[model samples]
Target: MWSWVLHRITGVAIFFFLLVHILDTALVRVSPEAYNAVIGTYQTPIMGLGEVALVGAIVFHAFNGLRIILIDFWSKGTKYQKVMFYVVIALWVITMLGFTPRHLINVFSH
Candidate 1:
């Protein structure tokens, strides 16, 4: 139940980020000035936090979805679902810890 809820939440979050990313890239076609402005906003603290959340959502969704796929394709995965769940959590934590600071620093330093 918790896994289902988390999968839905992360999937929705990733979809939302994808929409914003598409719009932002499309703005480049509309106007370079507008695109630069949008890009400039990424340096802000709020957007930094959003970036962290975005990375987390993407990582979680990808890893968990892979787990789900393995389960669907093979019965062996059912026995290891609980272990995989912890692996997913660990991966999420490591990804965030390693990437978030670098991402924020790059955004701000630019």
Candidate 2:
């Protein structure tokens, strides 16, 4: 269902983020100035939005991974997978609420 699709999407999203993160981090060793320039670009409002998306992808991926683990290891998890997806959603909302305000302020108040 939708959870399966989203789980895959988030997994891919996280993988790409990590790939970019590794490459960008490697720039630090090659040229400090280049790394600083790249880091400066990340401070923009557009990249701030990307940061939010990154956070969401990470949160969803973590919760969905937990769900998959339960489904694999727990006898009754498959029976309640939908309920667990809802639980993951609720947690995501709560986690986003806690983060969005602070991140927005940091993104915009500068």
Candidate 3:
């Protein structure tokens, strides 16, 4: 189903971001110069777009994952899977539109 496919895709995307984030933090322990260099690369336009995509993926995966948890834990939630699906979609759209441009500008301006 579409939902299963999307959930897997978003989950993978979030995991990838988490890996990069951990690696970036690890660079601080390696050397401040190395960490700064890595940080500097984030200012580029391409990385800025990546940041936007990362945010969208995290938001979507987190919200939908929570919905899945509710369905598993609550009897009433199972009855509303369709409604929750729409809620997840709307939340994703709102978050992407609301955050992406601001984040892109901040990343690029730095």
Q: Give one digit per residue, the lDDT tens place, for model 2 in 1-110.
A: 89889989998898999999999999999999999999999999999999999999899889888998999999999999989999999999999999988999999988
Give TM per candidate: 0.87, 0.97, 0.89
lDDT of 2 at 32: 100
Q: Please give the ranking of all candidate structures by TM-score, highest first, separated by commas.
A: 2, 3, 1
Query: Which of the two, 1 or 2, has more lDDT?
Result: 2
Q: What tens-digit string does per-residue lDDT give for candidate 1 at 1-110? A: 68779999989888888899899999999999999999997778888878788788889888889889877887899999888889988988998899988988886785
In candidate 1, stretches whose alpha carbon ends up further than 4 angstroms from where it belongs are 105-110
lDDT for every model?
Answer: 0.87, 0.94, 0.87
Residue 89 of model 1 has an lDDT of 88
Flag regions of model 3 displaced more than 4 Å: 108-110
lDDT of 3 by residue, 26-108 (tens): 99999999999999987788987877877877888888998899899989998998899899999999988899778877876
What local lDDT does model 2 show for residue 38? 95
Top TM-score: which candidate number?
2
